[model samples]
Target chain A: MATIETPKSQYGQIADLLISRIQDGTYPPGSSLPSEDKLADALKVSRVTINRAVGLLRLSGYVKVKRGSGTIVRTLPVILRDAKARYAARMQGTGAGEVEARQHNLVSNTVYRQIAEVPAPEHVAQTLDLKPGDPTLLRSRTLFANNEPTQIADSYIPAAIAKLSPELRNENAGPGGSYGRLSDIGHGPARFTEDVTVRMPTEQEQQILELEAAQPVFQIWHVAFDAKNKPVEVAKHVMPGHLWQLHYGWDE
Target chain B: MATIETPKSQYGQIADLLISRIQDGTYPPGSSLPSEDKLADALKVSRVTINRAVGLLRLSGYVKVKRGSGTIVRTLPVILRDAKARYAARMQGTGAGEVEARQHNLVSNTVYRQIAEVPAPEHVAQTLDLKPGDPTLLRSRTLFANNEPTQIADSYIPAAIAKLSPELRNENAGPGGSYGRLSDIGHGPARFTEDVTVRMPTEQEQQILELEAAQPVFQIWHVAFDAKNKPVEVAKHVMPGHLWQLHYGWDE
Candidate 1:
């Protein structure tokens, strides 16, 4: 009987080589990788090892394998949230999506926009200290990164405050977005709290983001408070997990 | 014609009531909730509304609705990471699992432990400043929180330093754990960098974590540096995404 080589180390090495190639742009995003037989022969490894390596790449969100279509490199758009930039003096004046677009040299567009007056949902009411069913202005938009739908944000603002600022009701909330309009109305955000969680995308979310069934989504619930520590705005953002990675850093 | 109410608001209200019930312990973990007909009659909502509400809860990881079985409340084991506690003086002395157990008032156990000398994988090698295939000590453990598997951690240390400290090889590192033993041997951690991402679990990972097919996992790669800023240890932790929520906070 032949002795079997350790699978962990061998497969890990193969995966590393493939990842390096992917990182160096040898196989750019949307480009298909070589077949398993070709990789196994070139690397002098068994087909099983090649399969395992590809599997590792799939699990790492580096590549997507399709039945009868071969494997393709994944396009990963990272969103680096520098702790300093997030709370920067200037950033406090603009929306996060606008800042992300400027940093990445990409165009940010509002694909879908809807401004409506509706009953506040329970969570939103609690966050904004409004009675349930109270009238609130709902500004819903689908934000596009480089013309691709990347995130959906739904912002809720008190009807009294929103009605005072006509710009807040427009599709484009001027240059600095809602915060800029809020500042003009003496309700600028002084503090923010964000809660993040990950889960499988809902059917509606998958359709909006055009994601595969297996893809997950990141949900961020953000509440902005005024100088008095009273909540002024609450926004919920849903982003495709496979296409986005959030970066956070802090000094010890 | 009698007007039909909008489904969105009605369903959302129903879901909110159900979530409130779940939160207040009206329906405890692992206990089945009432059927759709019963819920609709009691809550004065349509059956369609109940179905949609239950579906929302299922997607949010609040309850699990099996095919043949009814919907049951999910047991959410929260591991809250306070910013101050994470960087606390004493936490710097112990393992993350130990600190998590203490904070949550739950018992933590090391269910699996293995210490081996193996060739360093490429990523581990790069982080540890070692050549690929260099000898390294791999310490693997599966941690359980209150008798339930919570996380799998794999730590790699240079073989040279690991050989100098015998306590590092033991299943239970005395006192403050591996860092303490490393300090005794002249290699204590000073700084750390952690990168976190989420993805679908592999077959092996699913089995180890005992997760469902749709469940995702969070991967945290940590590199620890010494006083000289040289990497001394690299660790990878895999936690169930549905069971964990990472918290980060900072003041401007």
Candidate 2:
């Protein structure tokens, strides 16, 4: 390959060169790139310029640096935007005619419902106004986009309402998923609010999510309300932090 | 101190003893406990049992075990619960009181307006509905509880609304803190949501938060809504992960 003499001021251009190489598999995830000195010499740029370019990549989450260890390429997770506008924009560009954002790229879907006998967690019980360990339906599913796990969601519904929805027992549901199933049963959630937090992965989660030891997982705890302005269902979603982008719109 | 007798269930007793010592500050945070054999003999327990107990603690995040190295006591981070009913329950009887749960104990609070103009990142721009380079108000605070560092939150608001709130200028207007201030100004947030994730700490965050290299931080992104159903503020909070106990609630 011909060595390109990139300009010192063109840090972005140099960073793009590395990104392209990684995309082409020239430097696979977890692989180390050439030393800064070597790269600077090869690119015919001062090491300081090369350092600045690498700094940008680090901030952008492209590569990771270790004090004694060399810089290593990072694996970018499958990112899904949480903003509705962004979702609509992406969906519009898809060739499929009005496909559900989830089903359009469905990797795996599951629905499990019991007699709602599982004890409610302290947090869940208080929110639902039930005694701790109250019976509730625990429905969970893992979603994958392009063969990569994107999100895992666990939802709990009070037995009173879940029992009313026989359709929920059906094995195959449409793109509407749980939210739709609840609506079909006449307990549609009119609004939802979520509390989000992020933290480093536990050993098991790190292994299951195929994430780096340092990669954190995002947690979204959502509570949906019914028409009477009553809380109905609570759901928890966990995903690799880098994989999802959250967005919202507000009036000035 | 008188050594407790070696109970028939030696491992459990051993684990309990060590945990008590750690909690009471004998094995204070970041300090290493005695070796397996030393601890086992001191507590008259078998090495196997001692190892198992340590393993459990590591899993529960009470301690960090290094390969070929000793186990170190982990510092617990104070958890900021979601804005919900469950928070009230957990914090009760903790001696901090109910309103204490309403706000993180403020350690350092400062407000600055137009201190500097910086481009909004892609995600921030979308949430605030501003061009990428539009100016925004950046509010930063460090929270403390039990006289120890708890969490650090940085909020970015549209420059326009921020200018309207004198609290931002005076530094002490809202009773419930910034959230309270929003409501006092008729922008009382009716609905709020947050997304949380956890991962390894950045070297800088770890140092600033006085966290060890082995520990991680939790990052939470929150958005508050006003009566007009508009997003009035978007804030990012980062805390040491070990001490937090996240809570959420929903009504059935």
Candidate 3:
């Protein structure tokens, strides 16, 4: 086995080197890692240093350690979040009306579209304060990151609001998307709340995102309200779980 | 091929049946699943109904569906959450030299604990307004739901607050135990704010939680505060991604 060839306190460096090899398909997932003693001898470092480096890798979710078995390489995988502001802008600007503001970060494979349909899920109906099987417009997309499949987002708008725009039905055409369409129709979200949950990838999710067996994904539910604080839309994103690190900072 | 023999609308029920079989070692992880046609035939249902049932399983991360091949059983996993209330009450009550309040979920197998230790991570230090590498007592726990590992938590507290009780270290002697000692110490959390993210499980996490290859876990970071809104402690929990659904309802 190729050993970690570096000095102690060089844990990050060693980790990066190993991770790069794995990312580049050198040390393929499930490959056995070199023993710490062997790695230290080859790297000209003490076992303690190798241990720390491996420990960091383990903590970061890169490698697995088994007592009877040896260490094994693990793939770096996660979800892609379209909940970012850029995505919101992309959906709106691409649809209709004079695009006053341009949204950037449009990847080649990304698909954006608006579909008018009835709300199918129970949770969505409750959020929109509509009965089950209620009419709703579903604006959706399958997002990609670096040409890799990422997320499937479907946002539902009440039929009453959706009927205001006959242009919203076009697969790729709607004024400013739903957010913009809502504004164009004289309604804008004054308040929005987001609830996020992490769970194992559903089978369809695993296939659509092509995630490995161990990868999970994030399901983010975003509800937007108009000036009257009436819930207007609920956007649900089934995100791939391998590619995000969320950071939240609060002020006192 | 065992088709869903229950009510058609009961998606979760079928999923639970399959999950229990897998969990109890009836069909170990990575085992092939019966074909939709076969299952439907066995259960005297249409393939459409079987597909819907299977779809639910796939969505919840219970099974994998391959185009050329067939469906495969998935692993039902657990989450790891560190409860901080146990420690919060102990630390605060001890500081006031008063009896502490202890809280536990009504469900059996739910548990809590707290301890004192130096915080180490930069994020925790920044949140607590402490210098890097400062001494802080760390209290944490492994939460269980019905004797199954739900989450593993790690919490950090400033040493100044921890020194209020001298016998804190000895309390952690037993593995997977913490709440009782916290009562003796008398500290409690008055408030808590949580920041959560969902993603794929790292290799280290997979092993710790005994997770299967396809399962992901959620990461929740919570910061507790005292009655005066002073920062008390920061806790991190790793929860199994597939089994959790977080709910947040806000009224306008």
Candidate 4:
């Protein structure tokens, strides 16, 4: 485990040494690190120093400490967000989330759903070009990646458009999710603008997502425009930052 | 200021109301909100509740509190990452970071620079197809937006290629930055892959970026490939998440 020389700072040195080992695959992801006492003895450091080093690793998201199970190296799930593939999936009657999960060899499910006709929130109203409090169909769902809650997504569409398709009112928006149903009604998204921000999760969000105290949330606001450049659907996603990486590629 | 009816939870309700106001432009970005005492009195809540609500807002990136200044609405600088524009900027001998800053009407400056020849980290080595400890040129700089430290960019290029262009070794990286100089030497970035993740900032990062305690950092790992699909440069950017929003648009 000790491949590199220790640094000046004791605990930091230990942490760096451990991180190097982890990176070099001496300890693979989801694998447990040695016990604190064992690590302390191996590194010729105090138990307190080893504990502090482990704490640093946990804080930086290199590892996670389970209550009874010991420390395990963290493995983040990567979602390849290919713009063209995502749009093609929507056209083929599959939700982009489902497509992403499938690409990662994971099953995606909607763990929770709340479909209601409510007053549009100010931000959503602005994106949809509707006045605040205007009636809109709000579909809120918790998307799970392999049965683990991964994101909270809320989509808003004008009440008129939502009424045109019965599928839009159900949890399974037949085939491609909302976009597929919208297309059935002669309105398909032609373009998308995604705005991503990061912040600490709220108490409620932390509970719902089962996020760690130090985990921040990625707030993605996606606005889809129709062929005519009119906003058709506005969605917001709050995803636990530590569990996910958003990957995108482009040609120069 | 209280346009909506308060919910059952006092502080949460107040926070929600305040957030609505902030979203609707009642409290514009960079404008200070009323004092705690004033907010407490207006919401008919105790000062403790008002303080808690304000703290929530701060954590959620809606506001920031300075030592003497009251809570001020946060204004996230938008970086429109247009693929064509970014690639064009790089081809025309301008760094993409500079182009982004110019679009936002802000001057981009490199406030810190560390150039060295060192071993490539495991990830960078893999991306660059180099053996660990193989010579690589590391150019690390702290990029400032209008004098505010916003990002720490670290670029790793193979020492062989880096040595071909003196511009790659210097702090200023004379016009068009490393990629432009790389083009002069017949190796230009033709493709790019960007991976974005979010996490809490370390103590050292917090001080370097002057980030708030609750702020998270966006870590972006970018790998640029040349016409032959060979990875030419790998870079990592750590940006204070609360102060920046990454925007990208795509057609369906």
Candidate 5:
């Protein structure tokens, strides 16, 4: 049998080897890799080559350098959010996120950081079908999973509806969350759309989510529409990539 | 009205201001930003402050320093893949990705890079409910959007099924592509689960997608199930984050 190397560069080959080790559990998640010098010595490669390989591994989300910890492998998330089950739960006028958190054996809490009627941002105004500078109820929340901040979601609602419902401006929304309160106010959401993207966390997002270096975030723009097809609410959620993955299932 | 500054650091505040300019269309997508010195002079800040602010902006996906283009605002994606629509299209024996590219006035193309029977990886084997090292037919393709590499998708099919279907081994899978061929072979897909996560691209992925610096990739593991709920096919798609976003719609 003949073994032929492909078009990969020398550093690329080294990175692939390191990745296989991680995948095969040699360098399990949350475990630190050996020092670059050790790896270079073992692989008979220069320090520069090992450095490039580690850089690739870092970018590939296999390992990240922590403040106090060395190059630790990324941890696998335990909390898995299924879009289908969450839809069913939310449709029943329940706190779907909290329910899922509980199912994962994690305590879920929503900390209302800010609840105020303010002029909407330009994009938010357009999304909510309001003129720029029109007043909107902004609910800022820090969602905690297992007592740690997991997500920062800022929800925007039309000022009229929010003003009508008192909980929309308070710390607790009583029975269900904000969605439940909205249903009681004749604006029950019938359909939802979640547009998901990814980017490196901003400075503020890093502070809020307590994300580490090289961690990206899932930037989800979620919109809820009433039965009349009118946009009822718009929320932007920023969650750490290491802690989250979005799953969607559909029957063919 | 009196104004009290928030707890944001100096560079953070500057990044926010610059973000506002980008949002307001002052620094439109794909447009190069002013020099660091010029921006510092205009914003009345030191060059170091501007550099830090720009660093934040770069991470946040507002802008990136292209090799020759300098700091250019990230371009908005013209192609939007609605998961629901794609699900329906695939269910009906069609290539949803190609349909979407056509809708966006872009030329969609699939370049088959490799097609062979290989031992399934441990993860792929587990996902497909097969024993480790079992033979699987691998179909590696590079999907092009508007004649540019947009995704590198590697699909794995059980050896038994692939060998039975002749077209599966060929670049041209007759009408409707591989999914259609699978349906014709009585192993039709009945349902699908797409698990999506984001990470920085590997060296190979970066080269294949022709991605710029600091660009992330969406790694989606799509599993197709038969009517009996048995996993039939497993595919791992690596798409440039800037070029794609997954949207899901549901009734709630």
Candidate 6:
């Protein structure tokens, strides 16, 4: 293994110490960090040095700088997205999302955006086995937690499958979301695969998400396959990376 | 859904156009982008504008600025860590990691680091259902892809299990990694859970991984559970986020 390097600089060393405190609950989340003056006096360092150390913490999403208030430790994510358990729950006709919301004391909701038939992009076409520029059905929505915008999903379905399920063109796809509509058409989803990649958010995404400084966004391509091993729905979800953590579990 | 904002600045517009081209494979991975002068002339914008446009791409990790080769699109991650499939394959006595290494035409290896039995940290103790500062076995290793330092894993085993399996003291825990030795004492893992969070790397982590600018690191807390639903092992993996993509699939 590569040898772990010890921190050299005073500020980096201070930051590491503070991080350990955060991990150990010495400084709990949702609590304000002591002022730079207090910290510097406590650590016997200059206020400027303390400020830089706190800046590093902010950059790492450990803390946030609130206007008119002190630096505060950001709260841990209220929801944990566990894919395997979530799918299993959904398959059984209930789900984990609302249960988590209740557990976290947050409400969940979604807002829809209307979009007309659109041409499939290159990647989407390849995934859905269609030619680029082929017409497809699109469902656009912004999911919220406690009325705060969280994830934006854009689901695309092939023309044939869309025709088979006319509800795909509506604002609501009835109960199980679009999966229920597909099931009605005898193309129920049997399996799902998701690919996740990270990137600095575009200006539009930042504005939409009201993202914090140095926070990144993840683009997840989620493909749903039917029992016959045929891909049916291709959805792309954009989420703020800092506010979310993905969990995966497998039964051996 | 939130309305998408149009790029206001000329440079931002150019960046969006270039990003679209990259997505469409007009500028493929490992390919050089057009020089500032040529792009300025082609788009009728100043060289300064073109430079700023390319800078956005660099920050977003779409491309990297080579010393004299101009900007080059970064190649995609060769390994797709499909969690469900990988776990099943491992249980069946084969795995996806090596198969992906062969397919990507790369070599994979591990470098073991010696770590003495240390007190379980607060989080590890909580996950393993032990008291804080409880003695535990440690396995530290850095996984390499094509000889490049990719991921660092620190696995902690509870004392009882460690005593049950003598090999836990050694660097190599025999065949199926630690899980195999685990099976020897009838404590084979029956389930696994992983929780991931993202943050900027510490100075030492950045040095160890040789991370690029604007890249983030992911901390994954993985736990293995026995058939009786008892937690036995807790491992932490630190990985460069941008160079890796995690895939999760589930059956209904």
**lDDT of the candidates, in the order given:** 0.74, 0.60, 0.59, 0.80, 0.80, 0.77
* For every candidate, C-alpha RMSD to the true structure in Å: 7.6, 11.3, 11.8, 6.1, 4.9, 4.4
**Residue lDDT tens for model 1, A27-84:** 8977999999999999999999999888777755688776787998876466554433
By DockQ, the candidates rank as 6, 5, 4, 1, 3, 2
Which TM-score value belongs to model 2?
0.56
Q: Candidate 5 lDDT (Cα, whole model)?
A: 0.80
TM-score of each: 0.68, 0.56, 0.56, 0.77, 0.80, 0.81
Q: TM-score per model for chain B alone?
A: 0.79, 0.64, 0.54, 0.85, 0.83, 0.79
Model 1: how far residue A87 lies from native, Å: 5.2
Worst 10 residues of 6 chain A by lDDT: A91-100
Residues B1-252, candidate 4: write the lDDT tens digits.
111222245777788899999989999978999999998898788999988888778766788777788778876565565645766787787877788889889888775457888899999998899998788999887877777787888889999889988777777687677888887888888888878888766656766777754467899898989999999999988988876777767778
Candidate 3: give the TM-score of chain A: 0.62
Query: By TM-score, how accurate is candidate 4?
Result: 0.77
Q: After superposition, how far is residue A42 of candidate 1 from its true place, in Å?
A: 16
- Who wins the TM-score comparison? 6
lDDT of 6 by residue, B179-242 (tens): 7888888888899888877777666676666665346777888898999999989988888776
Model 3, docking class: incorrect
TM-score of A-chain in each prediction?
Answer: 0.78, 0.63, 0.62, 0.84, 0.81, 0.81
Give the interface RMSD of each candidate: 7.9, 14.6, 11.7, 7.7, 5.4, 2.7
* Candidate order by decreasing TM-score: 6, 5, 4, 1, 3, 2
What interface root-mean-square deviation (Å) does model 2 yield? 14.6
* Residue B73 in candidate 1, Cα distance off native in Å: 6.4
For model 6, report DockQ.
0.51
Model 2 scores a C-alpha lDDT of 0.60
